[model samples]
Target: MRRLHTLSAVSMALSGAISGLLLPVAAFAILGESVEGIDSSWVFVVAPLGLAIGVGYGIARYYRFSYELTAETFDVTSGVLSVQSREIPYGRVQNVDVRQKLVHRLFGVAVVSIETAGGGDTEATLNFVAEDEANRVQAEIRRLTAAIEADDGDDTRPAPSTEADTSAGDRTDSAEPRAARELLFELEFRELLLYAGTAIRPGAAIFPLFLLLVLTGDPTSLVPESITELSLVALSAIGIVAWALATSAISAAYTVAGYYDFRLERDGNDFVYERGLIERYSGSIPVEKVQSVTISDTLLQRLFGYASLSVETAGYGPGDSSGSQSTVPFAAESRVYRFAEGIAGVERPQFTSHPAMARRRYLARYAILATLVVAAAFLTAQVIGLERWYFAAVAFAAVPPAAHLKWTHMGYYVGDDHLVIRRGFWRRETTVIPYFRIQTVTTRRSLFQRRLGLASLVVDTASSRTFTGSVPTIENMGLEDARTAHENSRKQLQRTLRDRARDENVGLSPEMA
Candidate 1:
């Protein structure tokens, strides 16, 4: 069954590519010869001639395919003329996944994949094995892993309760589809729309809309003439706003059709989500796979106590990672924080504050940058014989003071187990990282910072696996102190993570699995 699906897919891709080339060429060839038009001969005659070759390749690939899988290895053999086979070892297997497309669902079949560790490549799936075979292969690998684990005395820590084990089979972990768990959190059509509208992609409103405004429409009269050569800037701003509006409308229209009816559910600790406009996609995400949890706020969401949540799971694949952090996108802000609290299992979040910067400090930084601009304008005025009159007026136009507004927004929060980064004013953004997740930590001190005896700490999360928990720059801390703190914090965090895994094995695994 799986082989058939693979063959079908290869056939379809090849056929589609060939069809794309041929339709145009075939049309042009007949028309070009008929019209005797100036360029028509080349367009009509030559196009189809080239298209025929592509069509031939597609047909050949569709007809030739074969694959096989066993406990220790899986083999794939396929090609039109030349034959090829590749073998994969059980030790290298990192994950085994099952995917069911609409077409597969019709015949009760699914695509199975064998993912290996330590590579920027894939070597699994002798290309679409039967569902039972896929499950058998997954089981064999699990059985081997479990034996190794049991030899290591891991069986004392019972496996976590998974939605995949509804049926009691001989091999608990192997030879069966882990029950697909509903999402720990999920989103609805309406909420997904709002998220896609405001949060999914950054600068959705201002940047894209601005570009569209320039490309699609034009309006230069919107700027006031007396605003000191701000016409181009004004026109650009107007265009951006218009573009945002148009995209928003387009996004909303998609909301009604694509995800108008959707489902977000989880099984055990893994999440199962489904949504689509044309091609439907659904998958499972394990709890251990979750890398990060993000909560986003728009101006409106802030006031409404609503926010969007996004998570990057360990195995957070294409469709799994796209939704916002929270299963519920519109949850009140406090709810998200509480959920974060629950996920990290921290009751108290520590805080490290900075020396409050007064208006003086802000003006100091702002003025330094502002000085160059002021000098440039002053020199220009003198060169043009406007001297102190026009120059002073332009230089003292309160630009530095206006820029100073941004300075006050810089701050940081360092907790025992997490770091909170703060920057930007009107848009308040915050990020959190667990201590144990830090793969690397570094400290920096600028020339000015050296005078203040201060430094910033940059902690990078471990990216070895796909799960990226957190990364942040913590301020008002020295290199020695930061390193010491991180080391101690990590030791404590490791103990906690291990304890949690144990507790999960004892309490949650059986109940859920």
Candidate 2:
């Protein structure tokens, strides 16, 4: 066990002094102290005290923080006043991520985050470690985790002699090779631009634009004279388009910055991801922990023959750590499909389309929503004495085609090994979930669905997040199909569990002969 880098104390001291310096200034400003009368000398007095406190705290943290790695578990003990000791078993460790920010990069240090089967942020974080030491620690943990999983599995191979185990352990820590890592995918600048174009939501720009307007006051002068003379509806439309375009550009720049030098590679049964230009990140996920696979494409992506793929692991949130953990952020549809199939251990999800009647249901639903919107706009226009209600008619006219497109693209596939659900009109997503990973299966019906003799099948997985009472569902299936899917899913889950148990019990190990 070793203490953190010496720079930690300096960084901590600087941070504390900066934090403490604000207090006296704030107090003086709040007290209405005159610039001439204000005591600038207090900051000097406070700075050293703050620095002393910070440096003492940092040194205490460094001294208290220590870790020991064993064959089965990595033990960490840390605290300032009250001591906390935690032992994380290698089998339960989900990911070991190494992150280097600009400061850390300058100092040649990295922060190591350890995530486990229990979620809600990482279980442990070791800050400000030497870059080389961080890499070695990450690799060592991964090797230990892999070795533990292999050892726990009922493999019948003879145990390595003590001599061999020690020698093998020594080699495993240093065995990671750049050449051994198979390059699976890389995101280029053009692909990142395409990703931004397809993934950014135009509606999301409204809040930021409104914030800008509030902060900067009115921008009426920026509006063109001809556009300013247009009807309220037209102006609103123009503003939305302009804002969306601006937002898309910002999103493009963010995508490039966040994903520069993005690369994905394979290391044994794990996948390694590395990216970022300014703040580098390296993370790994075990293949066996994958809960579900999703391949998605927006309308623009469809036109460009590109798609994005993401994998969900148990106890891991989609937004946790490296946001989305995209397997392929942007790739040609053909390549994405190939990778998805390989990862999912299945052929393409050629699911059957929803029944033709689903189109009628979609049309009715969208038509009602569209009617309400148009009616609202008409009423507003009437109240405002504007003859711009023609926009309402235009909106209503688009509903039927949009509904038809939704129904045309929506489909589901129930297989012995996996259940696949496909949906979305503007953005198409196909989700493939293994039966063994499913925690529950349910059916739901809305009022309209009940009236239409339709229901939805919801698949619940341990890995999926439940937010705002919403879960992933195969919506608007015929009632009978929904029930059938529910029943089949439950049966598949039970069967898979039983089969796994049987394999573990009977087939895993040969009799000692």
Candidate 3:
């Protein structure tokens, strides 16, 4: 279609200037004494050079990048030095997202990201187009795909349809209403505040303390010998408070930046999310493309009756931003469950806990780990001539209780159409994956598990919120129970495939069936 916004050049120039600023610091850090008397003014030269390069590059990129939409395929051609082109068929398009940074918003432009079913990362990104044009493009793609799916009666094929051949000029009228209608959920200001505040990571609280320990090599080293003991205590207290405030402020900004004005809505057959303040983003997944829905809550969230929800789609990867696939970043626990059930197309799954011996196993494992930690702490304290050796015993106090909670929380449910895995100690997560989405299944056992006649059922799907390339698991099931669950999942998968093939008039090979 059209080229990116003209301001793309300025954005590139700013990016280049930032990179240029970092060059001097990096060079100085690396060179140290080697260039002791070098003219630091030369660093100033780098920024202008970078800006020139960026401007030239941006101009070339704008001219070389172009896209064209055909009835069945969307073609994009990009590159300056080495030209690259791709034609993604409507059937192959997995997900489409629109994003806008502060500058782009000010200029009324947005970036559109497209992903495919075959890849974990974005296939193409259309740089800054008019915000309305971006929305029209996203909606048009969904409309064409949906029309193709309906006519073909198949999920994986593009069918010819007169309705899908509309020109870009007609797309605004044809697609905008479908995309903008049907509100499902939107975050209110109060809920947004709770979400931001409670979402402050535990790491943030510990980070300042960790930095102090690393920098000084000992907590007491923070107090200089020349300082009075009372002054030292006061200074330490103030530092802790300051770090706490800094951490809270950082967490709040991060949450607000990523999730401002968050809204989730149903656009035709797709579930769409639009959010962000400075960098607005709109992401969507077809209802059928969703593989699983997960609801999770931290210890604090539980107290506040809040939880977060995320959906797993075939093209999403762990490296993607956490908020990208989030359905509800933070909301009441009850509402989270309601949304999960609707999107996942299943009732809240009933779960069965692992056998009683699993508790003993967890207790044994935690006891040994805690014992080792306490021993290490005691030895360190002794070597440092520290008087807080007894603090190490605190480790022993929490171990058994945490182990008990972990064991109690470990459970799974093989339902009519979905399998649910529930686990985690403090931040509990419950994931519901449909059987049709499962790609593989296996069972594994550690030496200890084997001795205890227990096995872990590992189910895998193309979709994963965890980057480890694995899906939800049923761990520590008795051997017989594991086998039964494995067998049930396989049967359900076959049934789903067969039914799909029958409805689509597609023949599945015996292996697929």
Candidate 4:
């Protein structure tokens, strides 16, 4: 068994001390001492006690935590009170991630996260291990996983010695040779700048507007009694433009910081990626575990002919907060597709657009939304006696173009081995899901869609839910077409499974077969 780096005690002690200090602070606030002017010198007395207790707890925790990398399992034993132990099998490990914050780097330590299939979060975390030791642990897990796959069905094979050296310092002496690595993609500085410039962060943009409103105070107070109306309008316009520029610069800087010096490489069956500037992350996505591949671009990026490619594996989804799944954060659309093809064996697909009625459906939907907006504006005008409320009618002008873009972008294609679905207008996405990876397929029709003789075909996979909280669906297809696609997907899934089973059987020995 191996212990965490000694430095972890320092970090743990700091955390515990902070937590302990919060207790007295909370008590002081709850007691209303500030209003009553109660004596507070007792806090000084409690502070040292908190620090000592915190240090003691930290040291105990450091000594208590230990882990072992066995032949077929990665075992961890931890917890100060009521110790808990877990053994994670090698074959089930989906991703081994190494993360180093600025502090961790200063301490020459890193956190290693082991993620297993069906585990919503990391299965185990080896916090504050030596950087080199972390890498060794990740590599050993991969080597063991590969070995287990190779030895499947061979129950007679002897397990490696349980007494094997598991110490962090000595394990490397008997470690397997590193796999040959091929440079796959690296983000260029110029492309990184372009990506940052084109990236749209609505949340960040809205924040500045809110801040401006809050800082400016009451809206009516912004107009001074001596100021002319025209000058006030001019000042507002200038402020809005300045706010826009400020928000854009802030968003760009954020993107640059996150994706600085991104690099990706293929090592045997896994693709490894490292990115970030202040807080670095290195993660692996096993090729065989990939559930789907997505090529997406925002409206601005699309106009610039750039897109991003990301893969969804059993361990990481696009929605994962870690954000390590993106293989190529920014590249030319053609180049992105080429890289995606290499990863998932999917070519640039020729999509079939939804039926003409789908276009009518979109037009009707947007028109209804515009009409509702106009009606609400008119009602507000009557209630508040405000002029120029008719300005809301301008939304009608956007309905046609918005509807057209929606129809133009929505399409689907059923390839020989993959099902492709494309949707969205502001941020277009094209997802390719392999038949074998698909978990479910279903068809649905809303009341309006039924009237239009249209239905949606939803495709689900083992990949976790996306950030948008939506499943992969090909919408506004002819009812019959949707049903046909649903049935075909089911049949293809079965065929792919059978082919895989046959290949596995062929590799097995006669006795095991």
Candidate 5:
């Protein structure tokens, strides 16, 4: 099986490299270089270089083994010069991730990633496996855990919408294929637009704009005239606007490319998320390893009804991002809330009383804004003179950015099952993470907020993609409210787990109970 994987990858690599290497021949022909006069050393270098390219491809393909199993172990091994193998114990297994690039999908293949909890720096990745085998591998992993639960007399349930799978992997030269459940979910075009919006963030255009500015600058001087023209103020407005538009377009293009026609399918315990444009990619996450599932939306998405999804799971060994995250990319704003719940499959109680600050809530930001406004005014007052009418006019004009910040910053709320946070403009995001998935929750007090008897909360979790990865929120809220939110969420998790246990105990009556 490993050899088969190796051969397939090598073939693909060689096909591309061979085509590229032919460019030299084209160049030589154009220059009228005689083929007969070509040195033997050139062939020696080129032949081995071409062959090494194939080997490189094979090395990357490197799957030790791929198969399905019962409540025991699944083994995969393959490496040529230095053989490496792993026997992943069923109990230690954390998650199963399945992904595919455009190439793999074209070949009806999926990359299977097996993740376990025990190994500190352990990883297992099978580059190209038949989708059937990928499902088989996932099913076997879940089956083993179920078998253990049954033996321990613990009530175990299969995944929602999935039936108990009875098929076993065939152990033969011509093994009978096991059919695993193909769970299908797709993203809406509107959601894709939202995805395009976020995926192409500010940084998207920073590099391109920087490059363009550099191009328009004295390259030999190492600094652009745009930086220098800032003193001239009005002079660079055209250049700055051009830069902003260019960046927006670049970001928009990036958003489109990153998430095109995203799909996620569950094959047993493994979840496969498919996405991308030209350099297509597929990412997988395992259920057991799932730390959290987050449905997030920017303000624009909220208006348009779209959101992006992120899943945090145990990573496959080391250097394996399979269990990391996958997003719908683009989704309509209205559908975001429903889609998020659909993925979570649970109703969390949300407090109807949305937390809000009185109009005075924007006072917290007043000090900072005053600094900027006063400075701008002071500079003008100093340079142009602090004339009575001009000073009054500047003071009034400065009120808007501060007022906008205050209004935008004016929201906070608690949900029965999750916490909701919103911040930013144009890229405003509302993120929802279930209490069950909360790993670390803490609050910080800036010196000023501390003096004001207010603080901020920071929420951190494993799945680094779907969620902001790290949410450091500074909202104008009471200290007690922050603590209560954390405590309530924690208590809810305990109750849910206990309820699950109690509900699973059907024959627990009196003595037997």
Candidate 6:
């Protein structure tokens, strides 16, 4: 059994003390009272008590937690009050991630997270381990998993011992030689800047603005009386512009910081990536376990002829955005496609567009939306005795172009062994899913789509769900085309799985006979 590095207790103590200090601050904020009035004398008492409790708890936790690697499983025993034990088999291990924040790096420690397929979250976390120990653990787990898989069900064969000798004291030696890594892609500083600049995040700006309001005590109070007297519509327009600018600046800064010095390399059958400046992350994605490959570009990125490529695996759930590793955060569209081809063994697809009725449907939807907005503005103007509200009717002019762009960008293609689905105008995405990896094929029709003789075809894989809630969908296809695609996908999936099973059986040893 191996315990965490000695410094882990110190780290935990610091974290616990910080959490304790924030309790009063949080309470004051929740009660809508200022924290500035707290007596200085109470700080001495509260701080010492919090520090003592934190130190005591940290020491206890350190003694209680221990982990060991055995022949078949990586076993962990943890918890101070309620002892819980977990045994994670090497065969089920999907990824071993090493993460280091600035403080952890300073302390010469890292966090190792072990993830398994369908786990949704990290299956096991070895927190605050020595950096060398973390690397050894990651390599050992990979070697053990590979060995197990290669054994081919020979149960009587003895498994190699992977347990490390804790008495050796911080040794980093591994039993097997590490695989040579080939550099596949690296983001240049200029490219990183471009990627950061293209990030559009209007929603992320709200939190900062809200925080400012909470801390400053009122938006109107910060401005002049003359500015506060502005019309509601004018004030809203100003606020929207301010929000957009704030969002762009903050999001760009965040992107640059998060993806600094990004690099992706191939180590045998796994793709390894390292990224980040303040909080570094190094993780691996097995090529064989990949469920889908996605190529996406935002409106600005498309305009700049840049796109990003990401790969998804079953080890992480849809809600875990970090699970989908972006192999190319920002690159020339052609470059992105080339990288995707090298990784997934698939080429750029020639997509077939949806029927013309789909365009009309989009136009109708936007036109109705514009009309409703104009009517709402007019009613509000009547109530408020305002004159310029009729300007909202200008939204009607955008309907045609918006509809055309949406229609033009939506298409799908069915290859011999893969399905390519493309959609979106503001942020276009193209997903490539292998037939063998597909879990389900579904077709849906809304009342409006049915009236237009159209249907939607969805191809779902184990990792199909994404941060944007976008799935592999061919929307507004002709009813017959949709039905044909659904049936063809199912047939192809079955055939692919059968062929794979047959191949596996043929590769089995003669001892089975």
Q: Which numbered prediction scores highest in TM-score against the true structure?
A: 4
Tens-place lDDT per residue, model 1, 1-513, is 124444455545666567767776667767766766546546555556556655566555554555544434556666767876676654455444555555655554455555554442445443344444445555555455443333454344333223353221122333444454333444555566565555423333455646646875853344454545344446657766777676676655544444543554544444444455543434333444444444456666666666644444332322322332233344567766665555544333444444433334445666666677777767865653433433334544565555454445455555655555554444544555555555666676777667666666766553332212224565556545666655666675676567656664311122121
* CA deviation > 4 Å runs, candidate 1: 4-52, 60-200, 203-240, 250-262, 277-279, 314-328, 347-350, 356-430, 445-452, 464-471, 475-481, 493-513
Candidate 2 residues 80-197, lDDT tens each? 9899999998888888888998877887788888888786578888776777767766777887777766675654332211222221112223325678677778788778777776
lDDT of each: 0.50, 0.74, 0.75, 0.80, 0.53, 0.78
Candidate 2, pairs of clashing residues: none
- Candidate 5 C-alpha lDDT tens digits along 68-180: 34235666665656666667776666666666666766676666666665443445766655666555555556666545544555464332213344322212122112244
lDDT value for model 4: 0.80
| Candidate 6 all-Cα RMSD | 6.2
Ranking by TM-score: 4, 6, 2, 3, 5, 1
Q: Looking at model 1, how many pairs of residues clash?
A: 35
Task: Let me know the TM-score candidate 2 reaches against the reference structure.
Answer: 0.81
What would you estimate as the lDDT of candidate 2?
Answer: 0.74
Clash pairs detected, candidate 4: none
Which ranges of candidate 4 are over 4 A from the true structure? 28-51, 156-179, 210-240, 371-386, 503-513
Best by lDDT: 4
Error of 5 at 7 (Å): 4.4
Q: Lowest-lDDT window of 10 residues in candidate 4?
A: 504-513
Candidate 1 residue 126 C-alpha distance from true site, Å: 11
User: On a 0 to 100 scale, what is the lDDT of residue 121 in model 5?
Assistant: 45
List the lowest-lDDT window of 10 residues for candidate 5.
Answer: 504-513
Decreasing lDDT order of the candidates: 4, 6, 3, 2, 5, 1
* lDDT comparison, 5 vs 6, better candidate: 6
Preferred candidate (TM-score higher): 1 or 2:
2
Residue 486, model 4: Cα distance from true site in angstroms: 0.6
